[model samples]
Target: MSTIEEIQAELRALTEQEDEINESLDALLQERGVLEDQLASLHKLMPNLGLIHNDAKQLTGMISFTSQLADNVSGKVRQLDLAKSRVLAASLRVEDVLDLKFCTEGVQTALHEESYEKAAALIHRFLSMDEAVLQLSEDAAEGSSLKQSFTTLHEAAAKLRSLTHSKFDSAVNSGDVASVERFFKIFPLLGIKEEGLTKFAKWQSAQTSTQIEV
Candidate 1:
């Protein structure tokens, strides 16, 4: 069995590889008409989910899995075939203890629906701790592995850290309820500024209304 550190390193590598795959496959998302036609044909022919995802879903699954692993939100990285989104999501959930597998679950016994702000904070803390672990491991290690691993971790953290502020700003400035809701939706898991976001939304809406009336 691989040690946690080894697994972490593997996850970092996967993040980089999956990022490339995502870029290439993202183009497919624009081809919905042809894709739908193909899917309908397949459905008429009697089909199950594909044994493997086309590059697009596979790319999404890989990136999702890698992101979860890097997040260290779950206790284990579950197995997943590329074609199954739920399987991919489930595997990612297992990677981070903070991931809140189901954002909506049962009673108070369940994680009592964390506010988006709260969820984002938890994710932030988990990310910080993960970074610390990687640093410590590097300090304790005596090879290229440690150096390379720490560098990878630092890069990943940089990318993830910008998530909250960017989304919050975009949503608030857009003055769209949907955007605000989207921001909140990501908040619990993103550790964003909900109060400021709300205030900004309110202010923007008021200003817009005043301008219209003027």
Candidate 2:
């Protein structure tokens, strides 16, 4: 029912609308292409990001391991220092004992000479030396030698003690005043104070009675 002109005008308007739609579609496709390019770029960086994450994890583990290793090393060093100190102390103790060997010989000589006081003094020194050696036994390599020496010294001391007792009794029975006085002084040194006093009092009473009779 429309005229020819109206139909031509409608056809022209429809063609322009089609052109606008096609332009809008073209813009949308361009935007999609840009987004796709950005997504591809991000995908390309994924391996790098994964490598960075792995590196961070490895670094963290390395730090933890290094800290543990440091602690272990520090502990070992402290132990070594303590051990070194112990070794030094032990060496000094051994040296001190070795230095006192002459005192052990002196004790033997004094015992041989019936010098109980000197022997007792030397024995006291030896006891102190033995205590020090015992304390250092954990660190000493030659502890057996020290123990053997101490045993021999102890035996000698026992023998000297027996000999002294016999000599003192002999002197008392013989009524030798000079010998009795000399040995009486040795009794306290030998730690036989009560026994020595009892015997000495009996000998003194006997001497007093004989002097009164004379």
Candidate 3:
């Protein structure tokens, strides 16, 4: 071949290599454009992500506070319940003490008025009262006053028994029907039904014998 023909062939080969390099550059430029779009989208989302992180921190703090508040409220409720129970117990104790005082005074008044049934009823109520409760009141508050009232009531009961027996005997000897009936009914109230019945029967027998002799 001639020298001019060889040079033209070399120039054609160089032109083909330049076309391949331009295709590669175009592909790289498209890839760079996609990366720039992704970066812009990430930048837009960053502020929203920061806000979500702050909201999550606030919600966690609120949950912790709520739990602490519930615990405190529960403790306060228990304390209130315990205090209420104590107040109720103290009120009951005071009521018992008042009842004791009233009974002591009532018994004395009934005896003085010769209201045997009323006195007996008061004594029965006194007997029914819990001794332990009375003792507890004395130990806690009333002390000697409660003890003295108890002693007075005991003596008063014995005296009332003796007085009733004497009155019943006097009524039988005098043949006072109303008085005998009154005293007989009182004996059952005083918890001496059997003794009252025996004595009444003996009196009836003696009266029958006297009538037979007459």
For 68-185, candidate 1 gives per-residue lDDT tens digits of 8876644333323344676765554344322322221211122235234444444454544444433343323344554553454344334433654566567667766676565555
Q: Give candidate 1 regions above 4 Å deviation.
A: 1-125, 128-134, 137-150, 160-168, 172-175, 185-214
The CA-based lDDT of model 3 is what? 0.84
Q: Write the per-residue lDDT of candidate 2 for residues 60-137, one digit (tens) a residue.
A: 999999999999999999999999999998787767676456666787788778677788666656655546546455
**Top candidate (TM-score):** 3
User: What's the lDDT for residue 22 in model 3?
Assistant: 91
Ranking by lDDT: 3, 2, 1
Ranking by TM-score: 3, 2, 1
Q: Candidate 2: list runs displaced more than 4 Å.
A: 1-100, 112-117, 127-138, 212-214
For candidate 2, the TM-score is 0.47
Worst 10 residues of 2 by lDDT: 130-139
Clashing pairs in 2: none
Predicted structure with the largest lDDT when compared to the true one: 3
lDDT of each: 0.53, 0.77, 0.84
RMSD in order of candidates = 42.3, 12.9, 11.6
Query: What tens digits encode model 3's per-residue C-alpha lDDT throughout 1-214?
Result: 3798898998888898999899999999999999999999999999999999999999999999999999999999999999999899778777777877887999999999988879977777666677686686566356888897788778777887788789989999999978987887777766677988987888889889999999
